[model samples]
Target: MARRQRTPRRTDDNLPSAIDRFDDAVDAAWGRVFRGHPVADRIFYLASEVGDFSVLWLLIAATQGLRSDEDADASIRFSLLILGESLLVNQGIKRLVHRPRPTPTEPRPLHVRSPMTSSFPSGHASSAMAAAHLLSKRSPRLRPAIYLLAGIVATSRVHVQVHHASDVIAGAAIGTAYARLADRCVPGALP
Candidate 1:
């Protein structure tokens, strides 16, 4: 028999590793855990709803008048910051990153409405964190509550299968950075 030449297989470093796949795996795992839990679905649905731009605006409108003039001013500025950050994250960074959403292994009811944009840094988490960071600065007494809401919103993103854990983490970091920069740019923006 004639011998045939052997060729080596090429490896593409660009391919995702198990480490890189960890986020998606975690997202899928969370979806599996919350798949049929009615209470969890309801809570996550509500939490995600609070992060919607329109819902956030309503929240601002409802509470703006209840606080002092300075506090109200801070709240308004905080909302503006969130709006700007959302725009930047959704339209700019998301497109650049182009990270696709996690594909669930099985069909399950989503707690929140379907997402339209690419999933990398979550808009909901970004807005939630921005609001929490700025609002907490405006009212130190409400810091814990503000963070709790933000945490809920961020967690809901994962549970609802709209975002990976890393997506929320990136969103939070970006949001906090933006808030800090906004405060630095406008000295009184935080409080």
Candidate 2:
């Protein structure tokens, strides 16, 4: 008897399949929109780079910490908190989800950082929003700028083709949830 050839499993699912298709559309759109601007690509590359290991957030926390002794204490706390966030997202959660990063069909538009982590959730997106939440406490007046920076950092992950748009969206949600949870559970813990 001849054996039957097995086909790949596809549920023809609604939400999951729809989401994947939408994400692909967004990724393709991003490629088309930024196709030929070397300078724009470089800027995105650098923005994504700065998000590595939450360096940008740490810097902002340190700057805020420098303002006063109280601020210094808060800065230290916030920095540690961001690091803790990194640990949770990178080590704890990423290890469980083995999602792959987006693969570019053509030569990359610009240089991009090769990260060693799951693509299900973007670490850059997580840290950026988390830091925005904590650091905004330092100067409430700069809230808009702080969140804007966070938005830029989070989206840069997608623009540079290192992460899918859903990954970024989920990561931002996780980061926001974590920040809020930290605020509620550990009162006065974050800056």
Candidate 3:
């Protein structure tokens, strides 16, 4: 009997093969299933826009302003917190990671313009999750719906070929942790 030698597995030098495969699989799956539906495209476009501009969070803050002075103050603090988180993720962390955006494997009209920064951590996802976390904590009654929109906004990056699933996951984690910190430091931000 002869012994067989094993060949070395392939890798991307910077990222592990497993992670690369997972990212590729997710990107391919999303492109295959979610790229061409008219209604879904529209929905995701709107969601992406909301995430980009923090439109929903701004609207929530504006509505909170109408209710009472305390609510208004909390909303302003929440907005500032999310803005800081977005800046850190977009400028600091993304430049450090320097991972390129995924190459478009499918033809889908991008709802929002492509981001100029690197794609390791999604700014939109980070901002969305941070806003969702703060807002939901304050308004427990709307938590489920708030998080759902956050999720959709994060996933929309992958759907549109701008980010990998892992990128969004990392962004979500960063956003959640940052929001928790804000909640702790600025008492009453959560409630």
Q: What lDDT does each candidate get?
A: 0.76, 0.85, 0.82
| Tens digit per residue, CA lDDT, model 2, 78-187 | 87789889999999889999998888656776677788789979999999888888778668999999999999889888887889899999899999998988899889
Best by TM-score: 2
TM-score of 3: 0.87
Worst 10 residues of 3 by lDDT: 104-113
Steric overlap count per candidate: 0, 0, 0
Candidate with maximal lDDT: 2
In model 2, the worst 10-residue window by lDDT is 104-113
Ranking by lDDT: 2, 3, 1
Task: State model 1's lDDT.
Answer: 0.76
Off by over 4 Å in 3: 1-15
Per-residue alpha-carbon lDDT of model 1 for 1-191, expressed as tens digits? Answer: 99997788887776656535878677667777875698988888788877777365338534853678776666677667777888889888998998888665555565457787888898888877777777777668888987888888888887777787888889988888877787788787655
Which regions of candidate 1 are displaced past 4 Å? 1-19, 57-64
Which is better, 1 or 2, measured by lDDT?
A: 2
C-alpha RMSD (angstroms) for model 3: 6.0
Pairs of colliding residues, candidate 3: none
